[model samples]
Target: MSMTLFCYLMMYCSGIVSLCLARKHIMLSLLSLEFIILSLFCIFSIIVTIMISESYMMLMFLTFSVCEGVVGLSILVMMIRSHGNDHLSSINLFLC
Candidate 1:
């Protein structure tokens, strides 16, 4: 159940992809963050569950994920409002 090296590589690759793709869409920016967070949480939980059965690190990860998701969504809203639009047709200098 533990995360292996392969899982780490996969998560890294996906995070990069998410970063690239999310640049083109506001909604996707939020979604991609969620994807990255989920992958991180999953990987940590897998490794913890296998190596330290009694550790509650996974629970902390889950809590952090929720908080992050909330904060990320709020940021998305702020970004859209500040930009005065939701479309990401132009490269956002602030986000960059």
Candidate 2:
């Protein structure tokens, strides 16, 4: 409805598209996922602020983002340490 909301929507879509297209690249894909998640968190915070005019929700979302970032980086580090190549296909066997 608002310009900010529309911008967030477009960014969210672009992040999804980038992630889907960057299959063999581990770093790019993981970062793209983070981008999507960050955008979603931003959108939710914005909506919450508009509804309640509160900023604590933004801090809560950011804390969750920090946790997700830590986990994603840890997984990537392990993937690199084991395979020496950070591609998704190389990590799938570990999952299965």
Candidate 3:
């Protein structure tokens, strides 16, 4: 693998590990997830660039990541408003 690809792999792996370790902390988990997404985006962009001359794949991935981030933020806001906390355990999955 190239140096850039190796760097991306390391970043992606560390992000995944951080995400797993930060499961209990909502903010930390979200940041780690974003890190993972960014690394994946970079890797995909490079691959797409090499594979095709006309590629919208990177744009599509960027949009998807933005949407995902918005959704996650909305959920966090709702959870904080309703539960008065941002911890995963504080969220009640089923409430009637």
**What value does the lDDT take at residue 5 in candidate 3?**
91
Candidate 2 residue lDDT tens string, 1-96? 589899999999999999999989778988898999888987997888778887887888788888988898898888889889887676666666
Model 3 stretches with alpha carbons more than 4 Å out: 94-96
Cα deviation of 28 in candidate 3 (Å)?
Answer: 1.3
Q: What is the C-alpha RMSD of each candidate to the true structure, in Å?
A: 3.8, 2.1, 1.5
Backbone clash total, candidate 2: 0
Local accuracy of candidate 3 as per-residue lDDT tens digits, 1-96? 489998998999999999989998688888998999999998997788788876787888899999999988888888789889888887676974
Q: What is the C-alpha local distance difference test score of candidate 1?
A: 0.74
Which candidate model has the greater lDDT, 1 or 2?
2
Tens digits of per-residue lDDT for model 1 on 1-96?
A: 234757765886788698886686777777877777777776776677767877577778788889988887787788777787667665457866
Rank order (by lDDT, best first): 3, 2, 1
Cand. 3 TM to true fold? 0.91
lDDT scores in order: 0.74, 0.86, 0.88
Every model's TM-score: 0.68, 0.84, 0.91
lDDT of 2 at 76: 85
CA error at residue 14 for candidate 3, angstroms: 0.6
Which candidate has the highest lDDT of all?
A: 3
